[model samples]
Target: MNFSEHFLHFIWKFRLYKTLDLFCVAGEQLRILNPGISNTDAGPDFNQAKLSIGGTYWIGDVEIHLKSSDWLVHGHQQDPAYDAVILHVVHEHDQPIYRKDGSQIPVLVLKNLYPEHLLDHYHQLVNSIHKFPCEKQIGEIEAVVVNGFLSRMMVERLEQKSALVLDKLSRLTGDWESAFYCFMAKSFGFKVNEIPFELLASALPLQVLRKHLDHPLQVEALVFGQAGFLSGSFKDEYPRKLKKEYAFLKKKYGLKPIGVGAWRFLRMRPQNFPTLRLAQFSALVLKSDRLFSKILEIEELSDLIKLLAELPVNPYWIKHYHFQKETKEVKLQLGISSVHHLIINAICLFLFSYGKYADQPQLISRAIKFLELIPPENNTIIGWYKSSGLIVESAFFSQAVLQLNKYYCAQKKCLNCGIGIKILNK
Candidate 1:
C-alpha cells in the first residue's frame, strides 16, 4: 500500500524515524533539534524545523514527499516558497532535488528508519471495511488514551461550532441577539426545516419581534406570517385572527413572507410540524427579553433548561398542529429532549462564542460545564461507538466521539489522531 504525504509528515512530526546513525545524502551526520509545526496551507509541509548538520545548525521549513523526485513533480523547485527549506525528507531517495537557486538540498531517506510494522498496521487500519477504522483495536487502547483524545476532540468540535457562531455574528453586523435569534430559530426547526426557519428569521428581524413581545398574538402573527403559514385561507378562528394581525403587521413592517414551499412536513412527527415550531418560537420570543443576555448570565444547566422550557405554545396550538388541522389536545410544550438538543447545538455554542469574543474564560468554562450536565445525545453515530464497546457518559464525550468519527476516523486521518497514533506506535 502507498503511504500518503500526511503519513510521512506524521512520522517526521513525532520523530518516529530511527535516530541512530542518521545521515544526509552528503554523508554528513544529521540531527533534528525540532521537527517544527505542520503547515496546512500552500508552501512546505512543515514550518520552522530546527536541524543540526555537520556541526552547523539551520532553522527553516521542512518539506516531505514519498520520493525525492516529487520535489520537482510538485513544481516546488520553481516556487520561491521552497527556498527556505533546510531539509528534504522523503521515503525514497530515487533522484536528487534542487532548490530554487539550483543548489542541491540535503535529503533524509526515511524508508528503513521507521518500522515497517507500523506502516503495515496503518495500511491495515485504512484499508479495513469496518465503519470505524479502529473498530477491532479500539477496545485494546488504554482508557486514559481514549479519554485524552476525547477531551481534545470535544474542544475541536466546540471550536468548529464557534466558527459558525462567529460567521453568523459577522453577518448580523455584530448583533449578538440577532445572531442568537437566527441560530435558535434554526435549532427549533430541527433537521427537516432548518433552512426555512433560518430564512424566516432572516426575513423577520429580532427587533421587529421584540417590538411585538408585549402582545403574544401579534408575536405569533409576525412569526407565523413571516414563515408563510398564514398565506392560505384558514377555517380556524385563531389562524384567521393571526392572518388579520399579520396582514396589518406585514404592511406596517414592509415584510414579505417566505414561500410556503420552504417547509417540509412529510414523514415528520406532528409535534415537529413547522406551524407548531413557529408557535413555540414566538412564545420563546415573547417570554424572553434580551435572550442572549440572559443566556450569558445563566449559571446552571437547570436554569437554562427552565428558561427554554418556560415558553409553551398558546392554547390554540395545544389542539392544533397546523391551521385548519385540529387534533386531540396535547400539552404542545417543548420536550425535554428537544430542549436539550437546542441547548447543546445553540445556547452552549453561543455562550462559548461570546466567551471567546469577550475574552472571558469563565463563560467558556461554563459553556463546557453545561455540556457535562446534559446527557449524551442518542443518535446513529453515538450508537455505533457504543456498539464497538466504547462508553459515552456525557454530552462532552459524545460530542468528542462525534468529531473524532466525522473529522478523523471517517476521513481516514488516523495518522493525525492520537488514538490512531497510539495504535500505530504499538
Candidate 2:
C-alpha cells in the first residue's frame, strides 16, 4: 500500500487496522489500550498513549515513520524531545531503532495491518483532476457529516478573518474603532478598489473625520480629497466647492492624498465607482457618533442592517458617478447586498476579533449568529459548490464552502478533511 506518512497517521488515529494477534518486531504481544491524542507540535506523532507489550503496560509518546531508519534520518535520535517516545511505528521496518541511552525502541510494522481500501480511496480522491477532487463522490456521504464539517469550516473562516483583524488592531495600538474604520473602508472597495480605499483610510484618520462629522459636506470633502478625487479640475459647482473646502482642510490637517492612479474604473458598474462609494462612506461617518461602537451595541441583525442602510448620502451622488461626470439619475442608497457584504466582512470580523482579544465568548457567538441570519452570497465560487451537490442555505454554509474550497479541496488536503475521511473509511 503506497501512502504518505499522514495516511499512516489517519490509519493509526482511527484504529483502521487489524488488531487481533498483534506483535512487535521484538516478538512481544502488543495491545493498544489508548491511541492518545494526535499532536500537531514537533515532539511526537501521538502523545500520552497507553499500550501493553509483553504483558506490561507502557504509557508514553508514539512516533510513526515510513521506515524505522527514519528516526535517524529525521535526527529524532539526537533530539532530546523524542527521549520520552516509547514506541516506534513504521510502515516498513528497515532497521532497528535505538534510544540515545542504547536501549532499543520497540517497533511495530503496519505493512499489511490496515485495510487497503482506505488507501485506495484516498489515492483516487487526491489524484483526481476535477475542480473538486471529491465532487463526484461527496454526495454519497450523509448530510449530518457534511453539515457538521461545513459548520466547523464557517468558524474556521471567521477565525482566519479574526487573525487579520487582530494584526490590524496591533498596528493601531489595540484601537478597535480605528481598525474597524480601515477594514470597513477596504470592504467598501469590494476587491476592485480595496487597496486605494485602505490607503484613503490611512491618509485620513478616523479622528480627523470625527471633528468634521457635524458638517457632512466637510466630511465628504476630506474623504474625497484624501482619496485623490478632488484634485482634478471639475465642471460641477459641488465638486469645485469640495475642492476649495479640501484645499483648506488638507493643509490644516497636514495630509497627503493617495495617487489617483490607485482607483480602478475601466470595467465596473457606474454604481460601484470609487467616487460613489466614498460619498456613501463619508455619509456613514457623518451619521454615526462612533461607528464601531454603534456596531457593537447592535444586537439584532435587522437593527444592524437598518443602521447601515439608512446612510444620509448627499443627493449629489444620486445623479453623479464621478466628479465632472454626470450619469443618468440613480438611487445611491446602500443596497441590501452591499450592506450584507459589510456585515459579513467588516462587522463579523471585528466582533470575532474583539471577542477573542477581550475574552468575550458572547461576541463571538453573536458574530456567528449574524452570519446564520444573513442570506448566502451569490458568487461564482458558491455557484460552483452548489452545482457539485453541496447545500448552501445561508452565509454560514457559504462562508464554510469558500474556506473549504480555498484551503482543502483546492490544495488537495483530503486526509485532513472530515468529509474526505468519511469517504475513505466507507
Candidate 3:
C-alpha cells in the first residue's frame, strides 16, 4: 500500500499505529514508546514522536516518508529537521538512512497495520471522476448526522476567524467596532488585496478617520493617503490639494504610509476605480459610529442588510474623482452580495476561533441559516471545495464547505470530524 500526504497527516493526528508493533525498513522489530509535542514551533522537525528500535530504545523525534528509501531519496541527511529523528516511518521500507551526526535512523513500515478497506476506499474515490476522497459513499453516511457535523464545523469555523478578530481587536485598543471596520474593509478587498488593505488600515488610523467624520475631503484624504494614492503627483489641482492635506494629516497622526497600489481602475468602469471605492467606503465608515455594536444588536438579516443599502460616495465622487465637468449621480451602494459574504465570513471566524469548548450553538446556527439565505460564494476556496464534492450545488453549500474544512481537514482534529469518524467505523 502506497501512502499519501493525507495519510501522513492521518497518522500524526490519530497515532494510528499505536495498536501494532513497528518494524524498520529491514523488517526488524521496532516499537513506538512516545508521541511528542504536536504543536512545537522549533524542534527536530515535524512534531516530535519517540520510539524504540531493537533493545536500543531511542527518543529524539519522528518523521514521515512515503517509502523507506525516502530517507536517501529526499536527502534527509541534509535537512536539520531530520537530524534528531530517532525513527523514520514509511509505507514501503526500501532503504536505511543516517543522521547528520552519523546516528542510524530506524525505519518503520506502516502498511501492515493500515486496513485494506480504508485503502480500497481511498483508491476508489481518488481514481473516480468525483471530486472528494469519499464522494462515492457520501450519501451512505447519514445526512442527519452530517448536519450535526456541520454544527461542529460551524463552531470550528468561528473559532478560526475569532483569533484574527482578537488580533486586530488588540491593535484597535480593544475596540470591537473599530476592528470590525478594518475587518470589513479588508474582506471587501478579498484575497487579491488582503495585505494591501491591512496596510491601508495601519496607514489610516481610526483616530484620523474619526476626526474627518463630517467632511468628504478629509475622508478622501484618509482613504487615498492610507492606500498610498496621495504619494504620487497628479496633474489635477484637486488631487494635488488632497495630497497636500494628506501630508499634514500624516504628520499629525504619525502615519507610516502603506504600500497599497491605488485601488485599481484601469480596466474597470470609472465606478470601479480606487477613487470611487475609497469615497464610498469612507462615507460608510463615517456614518457608522459603532459598527460591531450595531451588528450585534441586529435581530434579523434584513435589518443587517439595511445597513449596506445606501451609497456613501461623496457628492463630488458622483461623476468625477478629480474635477467635475460632467454631472452624473452614481449612488455608491454596497452590493448586497458583498455584504452577505462579509457577514457570513465574520460570523464563521467568530465561532471557529473558540474551538469545542466555547459552545456558541445559537450564533452558529443563525449564521448558517443566514448563509443559506444567500448565494454560493464565487471565490477560489469555495470553487475548489465545490469542485471536490465537499459541497453540493446550493446557496448554503459554500458555507458547509467552509465549515467542514475547518473542523475536518485544516484542523486535523479528525476524530471529532463526522466524516472521519464514519469512515473509521466503516
Candidate 4:
C-alpha cells in the first residue's frame, strides 16, 4: 500500500519507531533525547530536536522522507534551511545527503524499525473506500475519548471561521460592524446565493444604509437595487416605487450594482429566492440599530432566536416572492431553521470574533454556550456521523463533526486526526 510522508512523520513524532538498539547508517548508536516540535511551515519537519549520536549529544532539526534521495530531490541539499538538519530519517536509505556547508547528515532507515502491524492499520485506513476510512471501527472507541475529540474539533471549527472573520475585519480596517453585516448577509443567502449576497453587502456598506433605516422601503430599495434586482422595469406599484427610490439612492451614493446574473433562482424554493432574502434582510436592518453591538449583548439563546424570528419583511413580500410574481399571501417571516442557521454560522461567529478583537473572554464563553443551547443541525453530513455510531447532542458536536468530515476525513489527513490516531495505535 502506498503511504504518505505524514505517516512517517507520525511514527517518528510518536516514537512508534523502534527505539532500543537503534543505529545510524554509519554504524553509530543513536538515542533520542527529544523528538522536538513539529513544524507545519517551511524548512525542517521537526525543529530543535535533541539526539545522542555515538553517545555525543547533537542539537538540531530533523528531516524525514520516504528515501534518502528525496532530500536532494526536494532541493534541501542546496538550501540553507536544511543546514541545521542533524539527522535525515527515511524509510529507505538509497543515497547519502550533505548539507549546504558540505557537512554529511546522518541517515536512519525506519522501514524495519516500526511495528508492521501499525503500518498495516494505517494502510487500511488511508486506502479504504468508505465515507470515513475508520467507519467500521469507530463504534469501538470509548465514549469519553470521542467526546473529548469532538469538543476539541468544535474549537478548531470556530478558529477556522474566526480566521475568515478576522481577515474580513482587516480588509474593512477594523470595521467590525461592516464585517458583521457582510457575514450576516452571506448567511441570509444560505448556500445557494451566498456569494451574490456577500458581493451586494460589500458594494453597499452599512454606513450608507443607516441613513435610511427610518424608512424600511428605502432600505429594501438600497439592498434590492445594489443586488441588481431593481434594474428591470416592474408593473407592480411596490417594485416600481422601489425602482424609483433606488435610482435616487444609487446616484446619491454613487453605488454600482453587481451583475444581475450573480443572483441565482434556478431549482430554488420560492421562499429562498434572492428577492425574498433581500426583503427579509431589509426587515432585519430596519428593526435593529447597531446590530453587531446588540448581538454582543445577547446572552440567552431564546432571546437571540426571538430577536431574529420576529423580524417582519416588507408587506409586499407577504404575497409576492419576487417582483410582479404573486404567490398566495403568507407570512414572509424567516423560518426557524433559517434563523438557527444564521445564529450558528453568522451571529455566533461574529460574537466569537468580537470577543477575540476586544479581548473579552466572557463574550467568547457566551458564544460557545450559545452553540450548546441550540439543537443539532440535520444534514447529510451529520446523518453520516450518526450512522457511524457518533452521538451528536447539540450544534457544538454537529459543527465539530462537520468540520472533521470536511477538513480531516475528506482531505485524508488521518494521521493528524484523533480518531485516526486512535485506530492506528490500537
Candidate achieving the largest TM-score: 1
> What TM-score quantifies how close candidate 1 is to the native fold?
0.96
lDDT of 1 by residue, 50-89 (tens): 9998879999999999989888899987899899998999
Error of 3 at 219 (Å): 2.3
lDDT of candidate 4 over 1-426, digit per residue (tens): 288789999999999987899999999899999998999999999999999998899999999999999987888867788889989999999998887667788999998888899989998988889888778888888888888888999998888899999999999999888899999999988989999988999899999999998888899889899998888888989999999999999999999999989889999778888888888899999999799989888878899999999886878888887889888876688888899899999998888877887899898899899889889999998888789888899898899999989888888888998888988999
Q: TM-score of each candidate?
A: 0.96, 0.95, 0.64, 0.96
Model 4, residue 124: distance off in Å is 1.2
**What lDDT, from 0 to 1, does candidate 2 have?**
0.89
Please identify model 3 stretches exceeding 4 Å from their true place. Answer: 4-115, 125-142, 231-241, 260-262, 265-271, 320-331, 347-369, 380-396, 403-417, 420-426
Q: Which window of 10 residues has the lowest lDDT sum in candidate 1?
A: 324-333
lDDT of 2 by residue, 5-44 (tens): 9988988899989989999999999999998799998898
Worst 10 residues of 2 by lDDT: 1-10
lDDT against the true structure, each candidate:
0.89, 0.89, 0.63, 0.89
Runs in model 2 deviating more than 4 A are none
